[model samples]
Target: MMTGTIENRDVFLANIAKRFGRAPKTEIDRPTWQYNPQNRVLKEATKNELVEVLVEQCKNIHTDIVITNTANLPADLQKVVGNYGGKSVITWKDERFQNYALSSLMTEQWPLENIQLYEWDSEQPEENIRQAEKANIGITISEITLAESGTAVLFSSKDKGRSVSFLPENSIILIPKSTIVPRMTQAARWISEKVRNGELIASCINFITGPSNSADIEMILIVGVHGPIKATYIVIEDQ
Candidate 1:
C-alpha cells in the first residue's frame, strides 16, 4: 500500500530544488506571527473539555455525534451503520480498524444481515472510487480532529482514498478522542513542524466538516444538493 511517509526526503527535495537552480536547505526558519491569538483559544481546555467543544460545534454542523470507546466501538459503529441502512459500506484501510476491532464489524458483525462491505484498496485506484460511489455509507478514521470547527483533517494517502468521504450518501468519521484539538491553528502548527523537520506528511490534506449546506442567497438554506446528505462523527473517548 502507498504511504504518506517520504523516506528519502533529501533526495526528493533535491530534485525539486534542482529544477529551481538552488540547493535544498537543511533547515527552515519558523515564522513568528505577531497577532497569534489562536494559541489562546481553548489552550487551557482538557481533553474532556475539547470533546465537549466538539460536541457543541456539531450541533450547528448537522452531524450525528456518538461517544464511544475502543471496547464498545464495534457495537456503536454497527448501530450507526444500521441506522444509516448498511446495505453497502466502504471504509479506509487503516490499522485502527483492526485495533478497534472494526474489521470484523465491517466484515461480519453487523446486526443487520447481508451487509456488503469494502475496504479502499490502494492497488485498485479506479475500483476504489467505483465502490465508494455505490456505497450507502463511507467510513474513515480522522488523522486530526478540530473541536472549534468540528472538522476532520483527513491526511489522504493511497490507502485512505479521498473519494470515500464524499462519494457516499452518508459519511461517518471515527475520531480518536486524543486527536481532538482546539482549532485549525494547532493543526497548521503541527504540520509546519513536521515539514520543517523533513518528516513524512500527506500530499493532500482534506479538511471536512459535517455535510455542507449553502445559504448564500438572502440567507435561504439549501441542504442535500451539494454533498453527502448526512455525516456522523463517532468519537472514541479512550483511544
Candidate 2:
C-alpha cells in the first residue's frame, strides 16, 4: 500500500510538471529576492505622520481612533465603555496594563455595583472564554500598530488570548505611540527578531485592521459577521 501511494504521488508530480511545461526541479534557487520597495517610503515616515496615517486609515474603515496621554487613558476608556453602555468587560492581564493601573481605574469607573469585569485566566481557559463571549466590551493591549494598514498586532499567550478580541460585541485596543510601526514589513521583522533571540513566542499573532464584516450573503454588506461589531483604538502618546 505504501509503494502504491508513492507511485501515485510521483505520477501526480509528473503530471503537474508536464502541465507547467517544465521538468520538476529537486533543489530550489539560492539567494532569493530580498529587495522590498514598500519599506523604503515607510522608513522615511515620521512618528507624527505615522500616527496621522493610522488614525485616518482607521477612520476610513469605520474604526474610531482616540489620541490621549498615558495619564488620560483611563478617562478615555471610561468614555468608550460609556458610549457602548458596556456592562460586562473582558481584558488582558498584561504587565503593561498592570503598570498603567488600568484595573483599578476600571473598577472605579465601572464598579461591580453595575458592571462585571473579568480578566484572562490561564488555568480556567474555557470559563474565561465563555465570560469573554458574554462580555459587551473586550479590552486588550496591542504589541504593535501598523500605520500603513491601521492594523493592531496582538500576540496571544497565557495572559492574552484570541477570544478576548473576537468574542465581544465591542473591541477596545490600547496602543502606545512608541510601538507604532510604519508598515507590516517592519512589524514582521520585529517579530522575527524576537523569535530569533529565543523569546517566548506566542502561539498566534493576530493582525486586526477594523471591525469584522462580510458581503457574502446576497452581496449586502454586514458588519460583525465574525467578530466585534465596533472597534475602537486608543493611542497613548507616552508609554
Off by over 4 Å in 1: 1-35, 108-111
What digit string (tens of lDDT, one per residue) describes model 2 on residues 141-179? 889999989899999988898999999999999988989
Q: For model 1, which pairs clash? A: none
For this target, which candidate reaches the highest TM-score against the unseen true structure? 1
Q: Would you give me the overall lDDT of model 2?
A: 0.85
Tens-place lDDT per residue, model 1, 156-196, is 99898889988899999999998999999999988999999
Pairs that collide in candidate 2 are: none
RMSD of each: 6.8, 4.4
TM-score of each: 0.84, 0.83
Alpha-carbon lDDT, every model: 0.88, 0.85
**Clashing pairs counted in every model:** 0, 0
